[model samples]
Target chain A: MENTITSIFDMNIKPEYLFIHLDAVDNMDAIKQMAVNLAKQGVVKNSFIPAVLERERIFSTGLQFDETGIAIPHTDTQHINSSAISIAILKKPVTFQAMGMPDSKVNVEIIFMLAIKTAHGHIKFLQTLMNQLQNKVILHNLINSTSKKLLINNFKSLFNKEN
Target chain B: MKKILVACGAGVCTSTAVLNKLKSILDDRGFKGKYELSQCKVAEVPAKSSGYDLCIATTTVSEVKCPFIMGIPFLTGRGLDDVIKKILKELEK
Candidate 1:
């Protein structure tokens, strides 16, 4: 064995996991597409799609940011082979029911699909990412980045020293 | 210690993030040993909420029997101060 280990901050988001200017009619379609991509990449099992969609139907994931709207759709640990995050920047915003407010809706432009293998593991990484989401400059950079290389670099840069 | 319930969609991802953030805030305010944290799925909140002093969740929950707080502030860091204030007031009561 190589005996290599990875930290959540150091986890590499493969270029294949990044999708930009994607088109989806609604949150379900967007999530389905992202889950399909993750499955094809061998990041998640084929069951990830229905599990995630069902989770979202009961518990809304939409977050309306000061600059743009976003959603973090995720499910429990059973179907994941490893931990990975899939990024999808929609071509046009889709309506997603707001988190903690099922009746409310948000026009979400970005999606962070989380495939976590442990219930409590990698929480620090999520917190760090959430804090970065608060910064409009970073979200703007992510939204406008043209290539997968740039997008992955932008995400990694969020964990840089200054944070 | 008072029981504090923190739940999300599947009890996996965001709930833990929010729980960690909430713990740090409570620690800073001298709340150590003043409360105990429990993590659960949103679907379990209705049956379990009654035993907890307060419930904080990232997803919409129905039929919660205890006082509830919206956990989005902890995630986004927006209006966090107000959320903290509300938490403090609730804890005090």
Candidate 2:
């Protein structure tokens, strides 16, 4: 049981999943670009694209922090093969409907596309990510990271601190 | 004990994040062990919300039997204090 719990918390962000300064015209474009990469890597099923797009339309994941705005776009577990997070730092900000507020819009700069395999499996990781998001320094580091290695290192450091 | 229901699009990502933040806030505010939290998809809110003292969702939900709170601030880190105040007010009642 201890091993199971440890392995669950061992979720890693793959180096290949990190895209620096990704170019996209809109929110859907941004999501599609990242979703396609995950699909190519066999991280998620082909159905993930449509499922995530449809889900975003109804329940947006766009979050606007004080200085930076980010979005966590994800779909159901059925669309995932393995649990992974795809990070895309867009070349320019794209407009996304704010979560729980369809009338409001957020200009998102970073996108964290989550491909989760279970409902409650990554609670700790998600919590840690939320805490990191609240940190202006970390969010600044993430947004200004120009290299994939730097971004992945910054991300890995979060989990490292947790364990 | 106060019963809290938290829902997102798929009961996975955002809800889990919000639930974690809510737990820590409530725990700090002297609510530890005094409440229970359950996660579900937003579609289930109408049916599951009746039994909960508060329904917090990352998206808009309709026809919730309990008082509803928009949990986006927990994610964005904006207006979170106000949301926490609202939650404490609801749960304290």
Candidate 3:
């Protein structure tokens, strides 16, 4: 329902981001709690958990890449301030529902949380990110990134057209 | 002619996204055929008496019986290759 225009080509998202190094989270319940806590603290705003749960009520965000419990929870842009993204790294790993794989669970340790600001422009952001996700090289870099700075720089570089 | 049914919670938001993806994939494959797109609730798939060539449902269905292509990654790529293949197969039919 949001009408804001945050574009991937506009370079709206930056490395100045907020994140929770889930060096200890072990379950989806905890993941939900961290997101809820951020929402409560005004770090993410009111729509984070609602949007996440709602989209998930439809489907899951778990991508189960590398079979190491990593996934992304990207909701609609209605609950966004801008094109800000948050990353959550779980220490113990958690099981999340997969797209069509019902009985099988996708493990999630790393979450590239997307907070898009527009109803339409988010499609482009998703395409860009998903392209990288489909690439083994970029996925490996993301999985190996240890610091926030590293994650930011690498992602920015990937999105940086000249890179 | 084969049909691909797109279903979602309300048949509005994400179904639209999936529709966009299907259009692009079909166009890219150089196939010439019109696809039948039906948006419905997750609970409404079976009751509809249409033998769609392929069903692209964005969410989980209880006991629905059809070849369903999940759209979780119509928004991403990891789940997109198979989706493209399914749509292409339907187009070839």
TM-score leader: 2
Tens-place lDDT per residue, model 3, B1-93, is 566677765453456566666666776766446656666666688775257666777677766666666777675455567767776765676
Segments in model 1 whose C-alpha atoms lie over 4 Å from true places: A1-7, A10-12
DockQ of predictions, in order shown:
0.78, 0.80, 0.32
Model 1: per-residue Cα lDDT over A65-92, one tens digit each: 8878899998878989889888998999
Q: Please give, for residues B27-88, the per-residue lDDT of candidate 1 as tens digits.
A: 99999999899999989999999999999998878999999998988887778899999888
The first chain of model 1 has a TM-score of: 0.92
Model 3 Cα shift for residue A16 (angstroms): 5.9
TM-score of decoy 3: 0.69
Alpha-carbon deviation at A127 in model 3, angstroms:
1.3
- CAPRI class assigned to model 2: high
| lDDT score for residue A19 of model 2 | 86
lDDT for every model? 0.86, 0.87, 0.60
Model 2, span B3-93: residue lDDT tens: 9999988998888888888998999989999999999999999999999999999999998999999998888778988999899999889
Assess every candidate by TM-score: 0.92, 0.94, 0.69
What is the lDDT for B12 in model 1? 87
* Candidate 3 residue-wise lDDT at B44: 80
Off by over 4 Å in 3: A1-16, A37-44, A50-58, A66-69, A75-78, A81-83, A161-163, B1-21, B32-54, B62-67, B72-83
Candidate 3 clash total? 5
Ranked by DockQ, top first: 2, 1, 3
